[model samples]
Target chain A: MSTTSPSRWKTVRSETGRALTALVIALAVALVVILLTSADPGAAFQTLLTAPLSSNRTMGLWIDDVAKLTLTGLAFSLVFQARQFSMGVQGQVYMGGLFAALIAMSPIGATPLAIPVAMLAAMCAGAVYGFIPGYAKARFGASEIVSSLMLNYIAILVVNYLIRAHLAPAGTGQLMTAKFPDTAIFPAILPGTRFDLGIVIALVSALAVWFLLYRTSWGLKLRLVGHNPKFAEYAGIRSSFIMVSAMTVAGAFGGLLGSVFVQGRAFGNLAQNFDGNLAFEGILIAIVARSRPLAVPIVALAYGYLRQGAQLMGIRTDVPTEMISVVQAIIILLVASSFSLPGKKLFARLRGQKSANAATPEAAK
Target chain B: MIELLLTVFSATFFVTVVRTTTPLLFAALGGLISDLSGALNVALEGMMLIAALTAVIVSVYAPWYVAVLSGVAAGAMLGALMAFFHLRLKADIILVGFAVNILATGGTVFALSRATGGDKGTSINLPSKAVPGVDLSFLEAIPAVGPTLKSLLSGHSILSWLGVFMVFAVWYFLFRTPYGLWLRGVGEYPAAPEAAGIPVAKVRAWSLVASGALAGIGGAQLAMFNYIGFTRDMTAGRGFIALGAVLLGARHPVGAMLAALLFGIFEALAIVMPNLFNWIPGEMIQTIPFVVTVLALILFSYRAQRARQMRTLSKI
Candidate 1:
């Protein structure tokens, strides 16, 4: 506990080095895969890492991907921080997208008001969706993981049924919903690019989450509850309330992601494979970021780059884009393993101190 | 109405149920073994997917049995890898399971295209061999019950027969053997076994590998017999369903078998119903199995809760 400052720095450096080593190992495996399958491994690697940043348009796509991943990652981070494994973010997103599309298509309000209303509806829908599992777990002591996982399939199937039965536009047979009106569309920040105001919302949301989880008394209570519910209860904290609220907040974040994707990117339409596996990707990003709200955006950007790079690799070389999935799997394996290592306790202590110091700055002011 | 009922109970429906249940039964057994040992092998889905592809690809060159064995070996290797990471490297078991799943989802497709010369969806063009069905025509010579027995048991894959035997073998191993007790003790409370000088990690690791091998066999059944070829996402959530079955079966070997059979019945219906009821869409029909899984789980949970409540009431 009374180690020298240089020694502490060395410890931090070593942890970072271990993390980088894991990433390097993953990349090496990918490189071997590329070498085996493709004509040139070096060129494939170069294309994968650099091509996403090569042009404005490609950069914008990368940003768009990051925005979506950030939103989902933030959702997962919030829930995970409470020690709640809510795997139904995928389901919540489906409901969110559905509600957003419904709002966008309905002639209920003006365009300016309609967008926010749609977003709010989506958030509320997601919150309600999450509340069921949270309530079940809190009251009945049911396993949230099993419930959440089951609900995901139900949500997908329910959405699929709705899209095919009522929401589908004329001449559409692939179970896709009708496109929203032009007025419901999100305004793009970059011309001729997918980048939209969603990026700003995602960044602002991360900042808000960081503040909420650090500066507030409730945040401290939540953390205490997450770490040890019995101790938190003894400390006079309402653990159930925190659990429900945390889950609702997590769900709202998931809803926001889906709504933003629908309004900004997909133009308020839902496809059969509308999920795009973003929820899973978000889980990976959250794990990689160690469930830190602030770190989500950074990790999400890296994920976005990797995804874009994988696509580029697929295009330029014989390497299939699915290699990205393999890389993600390897990274999770490495990261989860790293976290369980003996040195991670020291790393957590350091992180705890850093977060505590960071929390005090706004409090002092 | 009688004709419709007859059609529902026909040989085709029977075969469909058998085909659907074979893989699910194997996977359920896999899940039960690991779970009983206190290691929930969530990677069953991923293992099955990879094995299905492996079997399909390998069958192009080797015999169907060899292909199936290759798939099982692949799953065993993955299980060993999981054990290495989780037991030795100290990784989270769930995370390791998910990593395997993610790898399977992506790796299978990548390898599939390479194997099939860039086809991503189906391995129809590949000369993959089918699992040889058991010739039970000899049963017909056994008198009156012979034809009935042949209809019930005949034309099933060789792997299906192995599945039946493995169930009994697994049950025997768990109930009678010293290793089974050690595995169960490790799962229920690792500290007790650790105190007794039994290597807790080693038991869990072997359980995971065994689970993976069982799941791999299930995958081979799916590719070689169920559909006769591999398709992208052909398991379609059966692995997860098998996980549910593991619980619904009360985490016992026999219970898993019954649960698998029940789900197989629903899946068989789903497959057969679309053809019979022209009014119902194929997608809706296909969703029956998943829907039934949720309903069955809910009922199971409700009953468990009720049983607990009753016990408390009796105590009071």
Candidate 2:
């Protein structure tokens, strides 16, 4: 046990070191892009690095971005861990937001139970929306990526149709629902900022997912299926059931994000394309976090900081904020790439030690 | 309903379907080639988008055919980059595909702003040339079916005709040649081909390049002929739809063309419905192609599963 602990610590240290290296390299790539595009590259680069910390407002936005990305990141991590590439989170967010807004505007929203009730409804909506692609993959052998993408377009259109046809107040020019009642709104946790109970919800949700993925038999079964589906099936595990459940639970997280967006001060009403590309951004966060439930929030925080800074840079300089996406793509490619670095021998030795431990009977599962 | 039927039967609607199907057909063919090579090119969306913008920007300075060729080159280069990352560096193909998409989305907007001197939403300010439509008004000189043939076939983009020829060409290349068999063998079971002394990795890499080039032609058709200018996200999920078309076409070249045409018909309906049915929201109309793609894919999967089960039962 003592020997295993040291090796595990070494592995974690090496992983962190690699991640840091990747981040620095990604930033350098971003610097090159900025230099090529921006007339005043120095200001743009500085703004991209420091703008998120310059003001309370930016800080609030950054925190909100973190909270949102964390939830979506967890959502992506769950399905990805199950080895199911479900890109339906964007659609689930739209459905979740729609249901949450509907519940919030209903007469029941006047009660103190409104937020919980609305949130529950939103989660259920998201789960059902997620179930379509999950069922398609498990039952029909359909590709979840393509099916989920189709569902995303349909979900967006459905949400827009609903907002335009039924949810929006009559005579309003915009495609948006009426604002939620004050009782339904999540109160700001910080004074003069948009931070609210959603942040707490996000953190709690992250911890919950960690416990769910690490501390439960269900998680063990899910991970077992992910590691080897044929082996899991040989061991009497229903791989299909786990895949669906993973997606359904991940969908619940997407729904929670939707509810948070609509119920919080960030958007008190549902609108067409309100989620923007937030759900898609989660995929990057999930990959960056290495699909670890516990690591999602930290990665989200780091990414959210950069994203907020990029927005500020876009506003302040000629360098487009889109430059950050170029950096992001480069980072994802570099980090996800399996290259032999100088420490490769040491890393392989540590992994060999871990594999030797895995030869134990209990570890063989 | 009668008016809708009349519109559907008319030559103009047929023209719209052909025009719409041309881009999807190109992308779908690209997707089919890669899928046959065992590498699912999810970057078709990003490739098409970037190519569309490249075509638009390049057409402003060059001949339309050269502009189209530039789009193809841009897509082929992206394919090579992806091959470098996925094959050499061992990056996951899907993640790398999404990375390309992210790059395309953000990169295109950044480039557009620079090109148009600040218009990030579109390349409207750019004086891009269009692919010349094939004039077949001479068909009217014939006797009976003259006007009908002219209306049916005339004025379509020259690339649209190329799209039809490419379908047959891809079919012949994928099935009729020894290289085609090798490509299929590589995709189906690389170990067998590797043992057989074939360059399996090279085959897959070249498949992706060809896939990207095909999708690039689709993008050129889109920006150069379909819309005449690049808008933000102008591919608008057509690349994805082409993926569905690849599957719905049963992974065959002909099947892909049919599936693309199927989606094309729905797209044409969506475009035409907004005018006829003022009662239905435009958003609902726009969803028809996506809805049909999902339904068709589900049905295709179901049938395929049944076929597999039946074959196993027969063996028993």
Candidate 3:
């Protein structure tokens, strides 16, 4: 085990290689599909890969999208680390948006104080939402997956109802809330684009999450609990408490993203089409990042770029934009399966006994 | 009021329940077989969705049965993909299931558009074939109860009868065969069978394929018989509901059938309740099936825990 410590870079390289392998497979599949359907697959692929870098505006939009995806991905990584599969990030985000809307509409405070308060309110709402499943799982042994999933639908419906009944703008035909006040919006950092201070917040939150999960005592205990509840119990850690805390933190992060989106881009207005695939996209990002907090931003950026490219692909080609979704699915399948590649044998020889220890994490559940 | 009461007791309601239950029953059986073999088949929703679309598209050019078979084959192919990732490539089964679901959600819409020249929804414009209904009108000539029996049990899609047959077929496959024992042993503890030289990965792979094929049949029934065409998201969470039914049914073929029937009755009511109660919102009525699923699952978990507690107390 001690001898393996010096080869950390090798581990990183191999993991990076595996992720790239998955990306290559996705690209290969997309190429085949494009060639079959379009008159120019090579041009389409080139457009997808390079369109974001072609213009400053496109680059800014790409950054904004990556910021949102990264925030949600971080949220997922936090909860998943505790071995709780909470699919409630979307629900939490909805609540956060609602809180932001309420605050924006209210005349409670000055602009500077109001924005922070609204963001905090959103975070609190998200934390409470997450706490429900965590408590249910710890106390009653309810499946978090089912509860979290059910809550997502409930949240979406409730938000839709609210937007239609009370939050609708005076003359709007569709179910959407009124535009928020200028003061409620986040200050734009990049001119001529939606890019705002939210990117900074997301990056700061990622760092905070990294610190919490790796540098803090509570984080250690949580990881122990996740690795083995029985072993953690023997070590005097309260596994249930850790589970609840982790979920709460995860939900808070999700809420923060929602608040950021509402305050920055949508101007605290809710729309009926707000069932954005952000939560599911975040799940995919978490998988591609292998649930690593630090890796989330990189994966999110890649996804954001792919999404933009796919949209462009749709415009330039006869292929539907859903082809991007197919690519995403393929990426997930390949990345999740990359561990079983034959090349793993080479690493196995170098690590030897330590490789067996790694197997424990796979069986933790 | 009296007429409504009579209608409630009439054969139409019974037939409606059976019709609604057919797809759900098939999906539940699919879910059950995979779950007992430890795979859980979370992609049932996606498989059903894709297969539904496939059945509708293929039925346009082929016989209804051939269309259904093609749907099943498509589902089996997806199952094989999942097996390749899960058993061969060592991917997480749940994640693989989710990937399939995400793919199905987006892929079907893409395919639907391509097939319908950018229609993006309900294959209503497509000239799709319908599964034939079994006419038991001959039963009316037999006896005093024949007319009632014919009305209550006849005129269902031939697929519904096949669904009933599948329930027994799945039961026999899981309990009465040597392969069944091997599959069960693999699910419960793979090491035991691995020691016995039975290929655990192969069993899991086959189970996944069988699961997908069963789900495909359910999808075919939904498209070809239930509404005579495919619609985007027509499976709507039926696959997930079937998953709950798997657990609520105590993981048995009979239990799964009953559970599916219970959900089917509620679904049929959701379809009928708007006519009966003009005051309630349609959206609220549409929520009945999801609400029922969550409640049923909660009740199932509570009962299971109670049973465990009772056993512990008895032992003490």
**TM-score: the better of candidates 2 and 3:** 2
Task: Tell me the tens digit of each residue's lDDT in model 3 across A1-365.
Answer: 12276465665565677678888878888888778776677788787788777787778778878888888988888877787778789889988888877888788424667788888999999998888778867766666776776676667767777777677866666688776777777777877776787788888888898889888998888877877779999999989999999999999988888788788763446676474676778878888777778888888888899887777777776777787778889888877774555657678778774544242133112
Taking the tens digit of each residue's C-alpha lDDT, what string does model 2 give over B1-316? 9999999999999999999999999999999998999988999999999999999999999999999999999999998888888898777788888889889988899889989988989898899999999999999999999999999999999999999999999999989999999999998999999999999989999999999999999999999999999999988899999999998888899999999999999999999999899999888889898889888889899999999999999999
| Candidates 1 and 3 compared by TM-score, better number | 3
How much RMSD separates candidate 2 from the native structure? 3.3
- Please, what is the whole-model Cα lDDT of each candidate in the order they appear? 0.82, 0.89, 0.83
**Segments of candidate 2 deviating more than 4 angstroms:** A1-3, A340-365
Question: What docking grade does candidate 2 earn?
Answer: medium
- Candidate 3's displacement at residue B282, Å, is 2.9
In candidate 1, chain A reaches a TM of 0.87
Q: Which prediction has more favorable lDDT, 1 or 3?
A: 3
Tens digits of per-residue lDDT for model 2, A144-197? 888899999998999999988888898876789888899999988887787788
DockQ per candidate = 0.42, 0.63, 0.52
What is the TM-score of chain A, computed separately for every candidate? 0.87, 0.92, 0.90
lDDT of 1 at A187: 72
- Model 3 alpha-carbon miss at residue B165, Å: 1.6
For model 3, state the Cα shift of residue B67 in Å.
0.9
Sequence-dependent TM-score of model 3: 0.92
